[model samples]
Target: MARWPLVPATDAPKNRDPEPPEGEAFPVTSTGLASEQPLRSAAFRWFLAGQSISLAGSAMSPVALAFGVLEVTDSAAWLSAVTTAALVPMVATLLLGGGISDRYRRDIVLRLTSLGAGLTQVGVAILLLTHQHPALLLPLSALNGIFQGLTTPALRGIVSNLAAGRGLQQASSLVASARNATRILGPTTAGLLTASVGGGWAIAADAASFLLAAAFFARMSLPNLPPRTENGPTMLGELREGWSYFSSKPWIWTVTFAFGVFNALNMGVWQILGPVIANETIGAEGWGLVLSARGVGSLLASVVMVKLTVRRPMVPALSSMTLGAVPLILLGVGATTLWLAAAAFVAGVVSEFFTVVWETVWYTHVPERMLSRVGAHDEFWSFVPIPIGQLSTPVLAAAFGTAAVAVTGGGVAAVAMLMPLLVPSLRRIEIKRGGD
Candidate 1:
């Protein structure tokens, strides 16, 4: 097995321009539009194609699964159980997955995990189609979650390698656009499928999407670096090194911690309770439209980001995230479907802007060798609180009323989004021109 060389603390500066690894060639910089630059690389194009298709299907699966659980059990608690089952295992394995991606070839890891996730979705589709107990989706969801955890860190690291140099921001924005566009198509399709064919068929479409994405990944030709000597550090040692690097940076750790708190409050209320409220008021189709409207807003943001440059990225990134609370507040207050969709759209725009800038920060600043492992640490903290939110939200809702619990969560999340800005080091970080 090959071990990745560790980045020395002094050598890895914040805001450093990323260099291509020894074996890899820099992607040709495009003379065309900014968004077109990332498309110049055949590898990134394939990656985008696969990701767009996969995202569309993946987005649909959640709405399908959520409605399916409700259809079968008609209990908010059961919905929480299924979602929490997937999340707990994902949170548990993120560090291990991060380690694996750092230790192995990321493209290969992604291919295998996509295949694994697709197979799990197959199982989910079958269970739903056969009218099996909702409890049966738990194990399959857990299996799928494991694959997702493994996929995330590697996916984050690979983009810089694929796009390289000045193309990083372009790649990031383009990818976000693809993701947001799919969000529009996905939920709308899922709602229609669930309404007409069934949630099982929607899930089956997700399975096919994953399989197709794996095929596209197989077609990409990334360089395979030579293996390290046998005397290299053990996995535990590598992980310790990753943590050391991760924790030493106030900007990295602080932002991650803040988002962790924000996610804890936001995810549960929006995902679990929003659906319940929509079920009662607007119906499944209306909820899907609300989500789709959010996608439209995100898509618009990504387009605008393609040409825009920010010097102090984190300032606006963190500030804009406070808007994420709006949709939740609207949902809590029993706003009409149109009003809820409008609020969701605003939330989507700001959230996508934050995501694009933040990802560009990671690609430009983080050392390539350390990217996956460090990102794993970031993601682990960011996601670890989700299951807690999922499990407790129902109980909290039952006690204080769903509307009250949701409004409270939104308020707390708004505060959490601002906390990272208090760190002095985070405020000083800058993205150099042509670096993003």
Candidate 2:
């Protein structure tokens, strides 16, 4: 692994135009069309339209799947078992997906994956509707995961492909806002569909959404990507290449590692201990309100980020994340429901700001050729520790008490999240307009 310089500077190649002074807005092109014209691009519009449609259906799957499983087995353990089957494959193949995405046209990768995923979902829906053998669920679920694993990295990279250069921020913010809106709409629609019709129908709806997304991808044009340079490369070789790039970049791996630790602590405490605390302190209904408020905050953040500009994006990226622990602190201290909810809402707002800035910076800074692979590694590391956190938090809470656990995790998470700021490579990454 390469060590970073102590001074704040980028490890990547210097831009032709020097970075503007700290706190100055990024140097936009004279035309400003890179930022302005992305929305007008037919390709970007189609990409957004496809994602919007797919996300809406994908969102509904969680509720529908849960209920669908219940209709078959009526066991929470089975629910966990089947869902884990899906997740394992998805996580296992993420890096491979990234490599493939980089090797081919992203639009083609997305199209195939979307079609595969849609067909798998449709199969799962049929099995569920017909009340097939419960044993089939796990295998079907794993098949679903396989498609998801193949899809995700390709999907993540496509935004950069569709909206390059200065338009990235605006493109990202628009997609982010659409995704946030769907988070509310998807589940609501699923709930109504599940109640009025059946979980099977709701799942079928999700499958249909995937098919529509695939159709959109099939029709849309993508930028001409470079031909694959490494002929007859092995999968392992390509993966190693991606990993080499990922680990060599201090900013990339440092932030990724920070997220891993923060998510471990934060997710563990939140998912495992949160509901228990709410039961005792705020009551489940109040907790629901708090969660709803958080979602609303996320929606509002997407809107705010559309107009927001950051010169040194990492400043706000890391700074915004520090606020995430506030709600945990309040929860641990036994704050009232309204207070806790208010804190959660603020945390959600800041988290979205971090998200928008982080994505913008990643695409802005990383080499385009390696974007998918680097993104996959970034996601893999960040996600790998979540289960560990979720599993261990309970044991720790049992020993130290929930309040102590929550406080300790929140404090630790806050410190870990901010640690990347000390790294020179990360601290000075600039997001500027012009030049691909």
Q: Considering every candidate listed, which one attains the maximal TM-score?
A: 2
Tens digits of per-residue lDDT, candidate 1, 135-200, equal 898999999989998888888787876875556777889989988887777877999999998888
RMSD of each: 6.0, 4.7
**Residue pairs with backbone overlap in model 1:** 169-436
For model 1, what is the C-alpha lDDT against the true structure? 0.81
lDDT, candidate 2, 1-436, per-residue tens? 2233222455533311233343223332221113345788777787888989988988899999999889878889988988889988998988998999877788888888889889989998998899887678888789889888888888777776666566777788888888888887888899899899888899999999999999998877665554545455666776777897788767779899999998898889887898999999889899888887887888899888877777778977787788888887777888898998898888888888888888888666665556788899988899899989988989998899999999988899899888888877677677775552
- Which window of 10 residues has the lowest lDDT sum in candidate 2? 24-33
Q: Which window of ten consecutive residues has the lowest lDDT sum in model 1?
A: 22-31
